[model samples]
Target: MSEHAPVEPGQVLPATELVRDRIARRWEGLNERVQAKVQSISGLDRTPEVRLIQQASSAGTVTKRVSWLRKAADHVHAGAAHLAACRKGCAHCCHIAVTISRAEAQVIARETGAKLNPKAGVFSMADSEDFGEAFKQATSGAVGKPCTFLTEGSCSIYAHRPLECRLLLNLDDDDLLCQLVEGSATNVPYLDARQHHVASVAILGQHQDYDDIRNWFPQGRANDTPSTQHKAD
Candidate 1:
C-alpha cells in the first residue's frame, strides 16, 4: 500500500481477526497459570503519579513517522527483554485513559475506514504531573472504560494502534496486579518508555493537541473514511 493510500478495511480486518484468535489462544494457554499467581502479589499501585511529557511536535508525513515510532517502541519492548504478564487477551491496561494526537486518529480512520468522532470542542492540556488523573478530573465522563478499538479482549486495530497503546507496557510477572480493581491499587511497574511518549508528541513534527482515543474514535469500524486526510496531507 502507498503511504498516502486510504487504509482499506479488507487490508486490516482480516489481520484483526487473526490477532483476536491469537490473543484468545494465548489467554487460554495461560489462564490457569496467571490465576494461580494473582494471589501472590500485592504491590499494584493504582495511583502511580503518571507524568505527561510533552515536546514540540516534529516533522514527517503521517505514515513514515507513525511507523517509525511503533518500530522503535517495539524494539524497546523487545530489548527490555523481560517476560511480561501482559498478553493479548490480558487487556486491563486498555481500560485506562489513552491519549492520542489528531494526526494518528486521522491516519487510523483513513486506514481502517473507521468514522472519526467529531470533537465536541477543542482545548489544550499542558504537561501535568498527573496527566491521567488531571484528565479524569477535567472530563469527569471521559475514561475508565475499555478502548473503543478493543473487541473481545483483543485490539481490533492492533497494528495501527496509537503510540499511547504501543508504549504502555507492563513489566510485571502476571496480570494479577495490573487489574484496575480493588486491592490491586498498588503500582504495577511498566517498561520505562517515557522518552518514546515524548517522541509521540513530537512525531507529527507539528504542534497538535492530544485528546483521548475514544473522542476521536468512539466505537465501531465503518465504511466511511475520514474526510480531511488528517488535515496534514
Candidate 2:
C-alpha cells in the first residue's frame, strides 16, 4: 500500500533513496557486511521524483524537499553566518589546516584543477601561514584544518560545496530567531546538527571502506614517506 501512493505535484519524499544512491555508487568497493546493509537499505528506496525533492531541499530550496529536512538548509546557513558575520573578509575557516580523503581530495582537485604538487606536497603551518593564529587553530580541538579547496576570499567550488557547508545557516542580528528558536527558524526551519550528523553517519557508514572525510587525511605525519632516509646526505 505504501509503495504506490500517488505523489503530489510538489510534495517532497523521504531520504531512503539518497542513502541508496550513495550505496550504489560505492557498492562494489564495500565489504560483504556493508554490502548487505546497502542491499537492505536499497530495498526501501523511494520514488525518483521524491528523492530529487529531498536533494533540492538539502541543497537550499526549503519548499522543494521532504517535510522533515525542509528547514535543514536554513539552520546550517544561519550557524555558518554567525561565525562569518563579525569576521567579514576574515577567511578564518579557510586558513585552518584541513585534510581531505583521497577520494574527496581527488574530487576537489579534479573540479578545481588544484593538483597536489608531488614536489611541493609538504607545507609547514608556521612558515606558510595564511591568515592568523586564530584561523590556524582547530575548532574545538578537532583534527584536520582548512580545506585546500578554500582560496582567496571565497570558495572556488561553491556549487559542489561540502556537506558541512550545505547544512550551515546564518541568522541576522535583529532576527529574534537567533535567540528564540534554537533549532529551525520560523521563516526557515532546519535540522539540528546532531540529527544531521547522525543521519549522515548512519547512511554513509553502510558503505565499508568509505572513510570519514574529517579524518580521511591526517594534517601532519603518519602518511608521509621516509623523506630523510631517501634524501642524500
Per residue, candidate 2 scores C-alpha lDDT tens digits across 52-158 of: 33464354322222223323434444334433222233233332223222333344444444443333222222332432343333222332234434343445455
- List CA RMSD, all candidates: 13.5, 21.6
Shift in Å, residue 136, candidate 2: 15
**Model 2 local distance difference test score:** 0.33
Off by over 4 Å in 2: 1-88, 96-110, 113-146, 169-191, 206-233
TM-scores for all predictions: 0.61, 0.33
**In model 1, which range of ten residues has the least summed lDDT?**
47-56
How would you encode candidate 1's per-residue C-alpha lDDT over 1-233 as one tens digit per residue? 11122221112122345444533454453545534444333344322212212112232367666666666655555544344545544566666656777777787888887788776213344555555664555344333466677665567777677776666655545554344432223245565567677666655643565667767777747533322211001
- Residue 105 local lDDT, model 2: 39
Q: Give the C-alpha miss distance for residue 78 in model 2, angstroms.
A: 7.4
